[model samples]
Target: MNTKIIKLDINNKMYETITAKQGDTKSRFLLFNLLDGSIPFSLENRSVRVYAVKPDRTEVFNDLIITDAAKGYCILELTTQMLAVAGTVRLELMVIEEDKKLTSNIFYMDVKESINSEKAVVSTNEFTALMNGLAALSEYDIYKSNAKQVPGIKEEVSNLSSQLDNMITLKLLMDIDSTNYRINDFIMVDKITRLQNIYMANFLRNLRNGSPVTIACMGDSMTYGHDVNSEDKRSADTTPCDNGSRHSFTRASITYPESLQKYLNKIYKNNVTVINRGYSGDYVKKGMERWNKKHNANLTIIMYGTNDSRADYVPEEYRGNIDEYLKWYEQAIIREILWGKAVVIFTPPKLQSFGDLDVDTFANGLIQLCKKYNVPYIDTELFTINYNNINSDGVHFNGVGYEIFGMKSASVFVSENLLKPQYVKGGTKLLNRQTVDNFVVNGTYSYSATSGAYTPSELNNTGGSVLNLNPGSSITYSFYCEEDDMFVIPYIYTGADKIKISLDFGLKAPENSIDASIGKGATPLDNNKSSLEFTNSGTLLINKDEVFTNGVECLRIPTKGWHTLTLTNEHSQSTGGTLVINGIEFMNYDVFASYVNINKYYRQNYLKYTSHPILGDTASVSEIRIKPIDYLKLHPFYYLANTEYWRNPPLQLIITDYLKGSIIYTFTIGNNSDTTMFHGEKARLGAYTGGRTVSNITLDNDTREIVITFNSGLTNKSNLLLKLV
Candidate 1:
C-alpha cells in the first residue's frame, strides 16, 4: 500500500484528506492546484503519517515530493507495488478548528481509462481543492497571534511556531552568511514563500466559494519582500568571534503581498486569490517576461524599473531599450486587463531621489512614457516623500514604506474605476499631433529624381539643399521615388547590420581626388588613421592608431542593404569616431559615443562613474570601429588590428589595462560555450581596443581580473579598465 494525503470539506469541518485503494492493484498520482488564501497550509493530526499495517494485513510504503508547487497546484503520485490486491490505503486533507479538534475527510478520484470517444471534459476545480486541503500547513503567524488570548492553545501553538522559527533562522543565514553554502540558496527562500501564499489563499477561497479561484502577485524583488532577520544563528558564522554580535530581522514572517490579499478578501466579504510572481533581481524587461505565463487571474499588478537605472548602459541608450520594453509591456498588460476587460494596475518605481542625475532623468522619462501609454502609473515615490520617512540604507525602504506602498496600490483595485480606461486603446490621434508640435523640423530634403539621381530622404549642402547633423539631433529622409538609382557623396553611414560606405573607396577612385581636397573640408590629424585599403570583395577599412582624444571618418555611399565594416588597432591609443555620410538613409540607426580623456578636468573636480575608470589610467586607448551584424548593435572590445570582431550576434570581449596603451593591450573575450548568435546586427563598444582577444592579461603586477567598461557620458570615448583582482 502507498501512503497518500488529500483534503476536502466534510460537513463544513477541516479534515486531512486521504485516498484508499478501492479494488485496485496500485494507487495513482494525485495533484492539486490551490488558490490564494490566509492559512499557509491545512493538515490535521499529521494525517500523512506511515501506517504500521495496510488493509489485508500488508506493509505500507510512503513516497512523496512535498514542496510548494511551481504554480497554483500540487501533485501526489502513489504506487501500490508493495500492497496486496484490494489493499486499503487511507488518508485525508485536514485542518485544525478553533475548538482544538482534529478533522479528516476521505480523498476521492475518478479515473476512467478509455479509448477515443465523445466524453465530457472533467473540470479541475474539485481535484485541485481536495489536493490543497491535504497539503495545508498552519499559518504559524495567525496561530501565534491569537493563541495568547485563547486558553489551552499554548502547546499546539508552540509546536507550530517552533517549526516556523527554525525555518526563519535558516532563511536568514542563507542570505548574509553565503559562505556556508552558495548565494543561490537564499533565493529559493523567497520562491517558497511566494508559492506558500498562493497555495494558502487559493485553498481557503475554494472552501469559501464552493469553487476554485486563482491568484497572482506580479512585480520585482520588493514585491517578493526582503527582510533581514535578527534571530538567525547562522549569520554569526560569517563574522569573527571578536566582532560584536547583533540581531537582525529575518525574512520569515515578512508578507506584504499576503497582507494585501487579506485586506482585499476582508473588504470583498469573500475569498480572493493572490500569487507572488516577484523575481529577486529583475527589471521591467524581466517582469514582463514572467507575467506572460498562463494563469487564471482576473487581475494583475505590474511593478518594475527600480533596478534598471543602475545598469551600466548609457542613460539615453537605456531609455531607448526601456522604451521598446514598455511598449511590449503595455500591450501585454492591456491584454491581461481586457481579458473580459479585467482590471490591471501599473506601479512605477517609488520616488526616492538618488544623487545621480541619470537615474532621476531615467525615472522621470519612464513616468512620462507611462502616462502617454495610458497605463495607470502608481506614484510609489510620493508615499515616502509625504510621510518624511527614510530607510536606513537610503536605498530600500523600512516597514512603513511597504505598508504605504501596498495600501495605495490596493486602493486602485478597490475603486470603481478599476476596469475603466482613461483613454481608449490605440487612440494616438492626440499623441501624433503633440509630437509634431515639438518636432522642430531641421531641414527637409525631398528626392524628386529630377537632378542626376539621389537616395530617398537624401540631404546635402549642394543643389541648394541643406541638412544639419546637430550635436544631439537628426532628421529622417523619406523615399518618394520608385527608381533604384544610387546617390554618391563624401561621407558614409553605418547601420546596425553593416556599413554603407568604406574608406578604401577614396583610394580606389584616384580621379575622384577626394583625399587631396580633404584639407578643404575635413583635415587628417596625426592620431587619426587616414590610410585606406580594400578587403573582402572591395570592402573598405579605416585604422585609427595612437589617437588619444577625438577623430572623424568621411565616406560616400551609392547603394543600400547591409555591408561589412571592420576596424583594427595599430597601436594602443584611446580612440572613436563619428561616421559622416553624404547620401545615406537614416532610419532606425541610433549612434551614441562617450569617453573621458584623463587629461581633461571638469570644473576642476574628478568625475565618478562606477561603470568605468577615471582619466589617467594605465590602459591606453587603442582601436575602435562599428560594424553591422544583425538588426541590433554589437560592440566587441578588441586590441590587435588583424583580430576580427566577427560580425556575429552575441560577441564577447575582455578589455584590460596592460602593455601601456590600449592599442597593444585590449582584446576580444570568447568562451567555448558561447555558440548562440546575438539578436543584433553588430556590436559597438564606444571606448574599445583593436582586434585582440586574449585568455588572460596581467594588471598592476598582482594578477587582476580584466574587464572593459563602456562609459556613455564621457565625451572622449576612452575605454576604462577595471581590475577584478
Candidate 2:
C-alpha cells in the first residue's frame, strides 16, 4: 500500500488540499499529524472521528486508526467508497475525549478521475432469486392459465422487478452500517434514552383512552410554521414578523404541529389536537410570559433559542454563560412538570447565515439541564442542518423540513414509549366559566372629522387600519355599547411634540381618562368643558405607572347605548405634527378590571416559587387566569366583532398547594347563585402525610357550588403557598 503523510496545525488554516486518484482505493493511505500551535496534541485514551461530505451531498462518518496516541497521530486508509466521488470532499477531524471534544478546522480532499475509468455494474442475489422464482412459476399450469388471461402480466412483472430493485437500493442507502456510499447519513440520531418518558404518563393515558388530547407547540417563528408556505416566506434580509404581525400569513395546515397531529392520529388512531402557540421574534422571557398566560395543554413541546441567539437578545448579565441565559427555559420546564403536564424541549438548529451565537454550546447546556431535571428533549441540530430543510433566510425551515421534523418527532414518541401510560394520575376537571369580551372599531370605520380631512395610513402593529389625523382636526367615533360602564381606549400614535387633546365633543361627560404621558388620570373633562393636553415622549414604557402607552382610557360609559368619543388634535396647521389613530378598543369595566388584576398578579408572582426547609420547592403560587381578550392582547391581529375570535372561552383556574405530610389545606367555596362555582368531584387532593387521599369533597346542587377540604394538620416550616393553574 502506498502511504502519504499530512501535518496540520490546529491553530492555523491548511492551504494544501490532499489529492488522490478516484480509483486508487485499497493501495492509498493518508496519515495526519495533528498539532496544537507548535506542540503535538496528545491523543492518548481519546478517539478520533472523521466526518466527510461527499460531492453529491452524502456524508461519511468513520473512526480513524490511532497509530501513535501519545504523539497525536492517526491514519485514514482510503476505501473504494470514499474515493468513488471524483470531486473535492470537505472533511473535518473530531477528537473526542472523556470530558471534552475538539474539532479541527475543515480541510479538503480532491480526487482526480482516472483516464480510462468505467462505471461498475452490480447485481444483488435477491433480484436473481426473484427472477428464478418467476421463471419456475411460469412452468406451473396455474401460472400458464393466468398468464394467458392477463396480456400485461409480463409488463407487470417487469415493473415489479424494477420496484423491488428500487426498494432494495433505498434500503441499502438508509442502512447506517453500509460500506457503500450512502445518502442521509447526517440524519442519524446520536443519543437515545427513555428515562424521562414517565413525564408524559397522563398524556399517553388520554391517547389510549380515546380522549381528546391538546398539544401546545410553543416556540418562536420555527414553531409558528414560518417559511413552510408561500405567504409567510421571507428573504435573507427580511426581518421575522413579531407575535401578531404575521398571524394571518401562518397556515395551521402546514405547520409542524399540524403535521405531528396528522402523523400521530394516523398511527394511534386517536383524537389529537395540536395548537401552534408560536410567537415569532420572541425570546425565552417573552415565551415564559405567553405560556403563563394560557398553556392548557396535555403536552407542551417548547422549541426556542433561535431568536435568543441574536446579538442583543439576552441581557448583559446573561450573555456568555449558557446556564444563566437558559434560566427562563429551566423555569418553564419546572413549571410544566409541577402542573402535572408533559413537556418536551427542542434545542434549535444552528444558524446557517444568521446570527453568530454559539448554538452548539447552548444546546449542550440544555441537554445537561434536561438530564439533571429528568426531562425529555429533542436535539434538532443534526436533523435540520441540511440544505433541503432550511429556507433562504437560513433561520426558518421549509415545508419539507417541517414535515420531516413532525414525522421524526412522532417516531420519537413511539420509539421512546412516551405514548404508554406508566403512572396514571386522575384528570383534573376544567371549570366552566364566562369571561369578558371586547369590541374593536377600526379607524377607517364610520367616523366623522371636523375641519381637516382624515387620510387612511398603513395598518398598525395590531393589523388594524390607521387614519392619520390632520392637524387642527377633531374626529368623533360613534360606537354602540352592549352593556353599561364600558371603558373606551383610543389607540393613538403621536410623534414627538406637545399636542393638546380635547375630549369635549361627547354627549355624556367623561368619567375619567388616563393621561399616560404624566402617568395619572387627568381631571374629568365635562361635556362642553376644557380640553386636556400632554406631550408625546415617543417611547413605549410598560409599567404599573402607565399601562396604556399607545392608548388612553375613557373610563365608564354611563349608559349601554350609542356613544360618541371625540379626539381633537390641537396642533396648528403650520406646527406640522402627526396624530395617527389605529382603532378604538371598548371593553366592559368589570372585564377590564379583571384583565388588569390578572396581569398585575402575573407580573408580581412571575416565576416566584416557594421553598421550605423540609417540603423542598413548590411550583409558582401565581394564578394563570386569562380571558380571550388577554390572549388577544398578547397576540393581536385584525378582526371585528367576530364571535369566533372574541368568544374563545377562557381557561378555568386550578390552584395547587404542596403541603407537609401532616398539614391539610382547606378550600372553601360559598354556595351563592352569583359566586364562583367548581366541580367538587374533579378537584385533585393528594395528601403526603402517609398516602395520597381526597379527604372531603362537598357540593351544593341547589347553589351549583362546591367546597374541597383535605385532611387537617400542620407541620412547622411547611410551605403553604398555592399555585393557580
Candidate 3:
C-alpha cells in the first residue's frame, strides 16, 4: 500500500497552546496518521518534518521528532538548545512522500521563558527520570561492552546527580504556578490505572449496541474544569455553572466532559450524554445532597476530594467523625447506587498538601470504599504517569492535560470493547504475555504462524530449556512466591490423548522424554506415577482419588514464593497422539465467594481458563513476589464464557448458602435453549479450598452445578477457588 495521512493531531486536539523558552527543556507531538503499512513505508522512511518559523521567516526548533514514528504518531522532543531561544513562532507540520512535501497543519506558539519554579521542578523530574532510565538500560544490558555504554552510563549518572542539587536553587527563584513536587519524598504512582470490570462495563456495552448512555460527572472545581491564570495569578469563580475559564481555558466548549462526549460520539456514531454537575467547592458531605433521583444516569463519574483536601473540620476526632471525609463519601456512593447508577470514582488529581489531609489518604479511602461496596473505580492517585504533563497549577489540568485524562478515563471502555457489539465475549485477550519476573524457554518447541500457535517459553527467558512435549516428554518450572495462595495453571494444548502428565514441586525426578508424533502412557522406566491425562479434546487433572494413593496429584501448588513445579509427560505404548503446545499461565485465585467453572465435560470443548477478580487478568500478582509479605492487596476479577459457542444469553450464579462442610452455588449452562450442560472428562482448576479427598461431586437435580463439599485444613471460609478447570 502507498503512504497515506488519514489524520493528524497535536496534543490530541485541533488547537493546543505550546510555548518555547530560552535555555529550557520541552517536547511536543507532531503525530499524524498512516498506520496501515510496513515500517519501511512510514516510520523507517524519514517521513514527516516539522519547522518553527518566526515572523521574519527565521526557523526555530529546526530539531524535531519527525524521524521518530511510533504506533501512529511521533513524540517531538525539543533540544535544550532549541528551547533556549524564545519567541512567538509558527510551527508547520508536513509529510514528505517520494520527494514531495505535503502540508498537514500548522499552529502558532508563544515561545517565552518557561524556566520558573514550577517548570524547573517538572523539567528536573523529567531529566532525572530520563537519566535513571538510561542508567537502568545500561546496567541491565548483558552485553554493555558493545559501545562505550558503560562510560555513557557513568557520565549520565554524574550529570543527573548534579541536577539534583539545582532543585534547592528552585526555592530561591521567583515566579511560579501553584507548586508541589516533593522530589525527595515523591512517590511514583501508576500512569494508567486499570481495574476490575465494574458497573459501567455493562452500561457501556449497552451503549455500543446503539442504546442510550448517560454519564453524570459530579464533583468540585476540577470536575467543573477549574483553570487558574498562571500569568495573572488570579483564580476563577467557583460558582459559575458554565464559565469560559472552565473549558479549553476559555468557553465551556471543550471542558473534559465536553471533550469526553465528543470522543464518544465520534467513535460510537451515537451521542453519549455527559452531564456536567460540577460546582466549585463541592466536597463530600455537600456533594451527597446533589445525588437526587431527579439526576438519574446510567453511569456516574465522581471526582471529589479537591475541597476536602483543604477544608476545615474538627481534626482531633476526624477518623471517628460521622461527617468525616470517608463518611460523606460512603454516603454519596450509596446514594448513586440507590439511584440505579454505576459509579466510577477518581482520586481527585493531586494538590499541595495543606494540613492534616493528604491526597493519598483521600485516594486510598475511595479504594477501601470500593471493596466495601463491591464497586469499581479508577485508581488515579496511584497510577497516573503524566505528572509532568499537568497544567500551570499542579492541582488542576488544562485542555491538553484534560485531554489525556479523557482518553485514560475512556480507555476502560475502549479497552474492554464496550463501544462495539460484544464480540469474543469475556477474558482479556492474551495478545501479549507479561514476562516481568517470568521465565521462558526459547527455541525448543515447534511453532506455527497460521494459527498464531505460540509457545510461551519462546518469549520467557529466565535461562531455561525450551519445552518439547511428547509421550515421556516434559519440562519443569521453578518459581518463587511470597504468600500461600491457591494457584491454577492454564495451558494451550491442541490435539493429544492418553499422554500422562505429572506435576511435582521443587525436586527433579526421572525424565520421560518422548516424541511428538505418537505414544500412549509410556512403558514404565521406573514406577507408575499418578498424573493428569491429556487429550486433544482437553485435559483431565489428576483425580485426587488416585493421587492420595498413588502419590501423583493435579496441578495445584500451595506454597510460599520460593518454590518449584515440574510438569512431565510420561512415555506411552498405545498410539499416544500428536499435540501442539502453546502458552501456559500461572495465576492465583482471589474470588473465593461464588462463580462458575467449566466442569471436566466442558474442558475438551470451546473454552480455556478465563481468570477473575482477586486474581487480576494480569500475570502481576499483588502479594509476595520479591520477598515474604507482611501485607497484601488483592486484584479485580475478570469474566469469561464462550460468548460464541453459547447461543444463550449470559448466565450468572450466586452463592445461596454455605455450611462448614458443604457450600452451594447455582448456575445454568448452555444457551438456555438446550437442556444439555457441558461436561469435561478431564479438568485442571486454578485453585480450590475444600477437602483433600472428594467423597463425591453431585449435580443438583434442581439447579446446574456439581456441588463440591470441602472438609479439613483451610478453614479461612473465604478461600473459594477461582480458576478454569
Tens-digit per-residue lDDT, 1-725, candidate 2: 56566767876789899888877735666667777754557789887767777776766655666656755667665656567667898888888877687888899999887764576212111121124332243222233346564355434444543443332212112222213323333110111122134547667666645678888888877787766345444433222332334353443236678777876664444577887777656667666655454346787888877766554665665545565557767656655554455778888754665546576666767877676555666666534432243353566666655665665455444322332211111121111010111111112223333232222322223333445556655454333334544545455655625544332132123222332221112212112232445555553211222333222323345343333345555554444565665444555545555545454333221122123345544322222222222223322211122233223222222333343243333333322323333333344445544422334433323312233333442222333322222
List the global CA lDDT of all models. 0.33, 0.49, 0.40
Clashes of each: 85, 1, 42
Per-residue lDDT tens digits of candidate 1, residues 409-468?
443333222322112111111110112211111222222222322222233333322222
TM-score for each prediction?
Answer: 0.25, 0.29, 0.30
The C-alpha local distance difference test score for the whole of candidate 2 amounts to 0.49
Candidate 1 whole-model C-alpha lDDT, 0 to 1: 0.33
* Candidates 1 and 2 compared by lDDT, better number: 2
Segments in model 3 whose C-alpha atoms lie over 4 Å from true places: 1-201, 208-210, 230-253, 290-293, 312-323, 352-357, 415-429, 432-725
Give the alpha carbon lDDT tens digit for every residue of 384-494 in model 3: 341344464556666555554554454344323222211211121222222222222211233233323433344445322223455544333323333333333434343
Model 2, residue 72: what's the lDDT? 63
- Lowest summed lDDT window (length 10), candidate 3: 624-633
- Angstrom error of the Cα, residue 338, model 2: value is 2.7
Off by over 4 Å in 1: 1-215, 228-252, 290-292, 312-321, 334-343, 351-374, 388-392, 417-725
